[model samples]
Target chain A: MRDDVPLAATAAGGTRGDEECCTLATGPLDAADAQRLSEAFKALSDPTRLRLLAHVADQGCASVCACDLTELMGISQPTVSHHMKKLVEAGLVTREQRGRWAHYSVVPAAFAELRAFLDLR
Target chain B: MRDDVPLAATAAGGTRGDEECCTLATGPLDAADAQRLSEAFKALSDPTRLRLLAHVADQGCASVCACDLTELMGISQPTVSHHMKKLVEAGLVTREQRGRWAHYSVVPAAFAELRAFLDLR
Candidate 1:
């Protein structure tokens, strides 16, 4: 009922847990892959996360400073950090620490994997 | 942490409720659209939902019978119904009640909209 719960918290899998199910044209999505895939989608399940991702992608280069994310997202530093942590855990974004600030970037391979998995093309 | 909660349940928007954020190459996703888009992805965030969707898509026809879904999914009729309700609410699938059976089909436009929204293609 609490809508603010991030996707990281949402895609926590069933009591059946690690069991896999279903087949696509490619093949069945096993439990491990499905679990990981769901987590990635869950990361994108939030508006803030989507914006955060856009901000990173909007950077267009390899990465952007963590400090820059706070300004771009128009959110408090801690809030941005929270969402970025979830995104990083989901593997949607990669973080690199430089000097004192962490830099974040979109992982094209993650997006590409999702695209293929969804067969959105 | 209960992963069984559907994406419709997951993308319930923030307490800020119905506010929009972030821009893609196309434009910023409004709160309503972000909510809707997130719901679609949330639906996909589950392996069960993904499998259900695949079964429907595998039908290759415009629709599949609700009764048929119960068999294909290998879940109980009620469990299938529960997930189907969430999918319906998400606008990912369409249901038509015919006689005593409800025939379900994937909404191409919903997937198309998500594809464009995510820039997944």
Candidate 2:
């Protein structure tokens, strides 16, 4: 994915029409939005997930497969997949299927929005 | 508090020596650190808490009292106090007592750290 592209767009595989880009303080977030955002944060709250995020981010812009994550996290494939699912669903990570493997990377805009949400002033 | 002050520093109320400011990507966060950070996010996960956070953040740099939150959230005084306690304990908000009132403000450094934690790259 192009680094210059918006996070939601990158997550959608360069398809910008599918998602909207907004900051947390742009306006009031509804309960559902807050709940959804909270779930993403909750998923990241775990040490395993935090490590998983660190691994993926450290890999440069490249995405790694679930197999690699399983080995790194010392967890089963299913468990890694579950965490990946949560990360992907939360827009924290993006998954792309290439041949027999799926690659994951961090979504910048999602991170930006979350960062803005935590903006104290 | 001065707007230019760092978050942890501001939370410490001009006592910068008491806190250290750092980002999530700077290094590995241990389990206890993750646990503590998660608790803060968990405190922010609730709708009422989110609203409270929003209210406090929206008030510029000024801190709000528990009495104001109880009315805004439509929650009881004890419940608001409890939520305030959680927020303060988590380090997401700072508490100051003036006479019989307890004023709370968002801690910027805490928000910055959390925002960094959410950073995908």
- RMSD in angstroms, all models? 15.2, 17.9
> What is the fraction of true interface contacts found in candidate 1?
0.18
Q: Name the candidate that leads on TM-score.
A: 1
Model 2 lDDT tens row, B1-121: 1235321321212222212221236345566776767777777767666767776666545566666766666788888888788788888777877677677766666777787666543
Per-model TM-score versus the true fold: 0.73, 0.69
Clashing pairs in 2: B7-B109
**Candidate 2 Cα misplacement greater than 4 A, ranges:** A1-32, A98-100, B1-33, B98-100
Question: What value does the interface RMSD of model 2 take?
Answer: 18.3
lDDT at B44, model 1 = 76
In model 1, what is the error at residue A96, expressed in angstroms?
Answer: 0.7
Query: How much is the lDDT of residue B119 in candidate 1?
Result: 54
Query: By summed lDDT, which 10 consecutive residues of candidate 2 chain B come out lowest?
Result: B10-19
lDDT tens per residue, model 1, A58-119: 54434666666676556887898899999999887778776777777666567667766655
In terms of lDDT, the poorest run of 10 residues in model 1 chain A is: A15-24
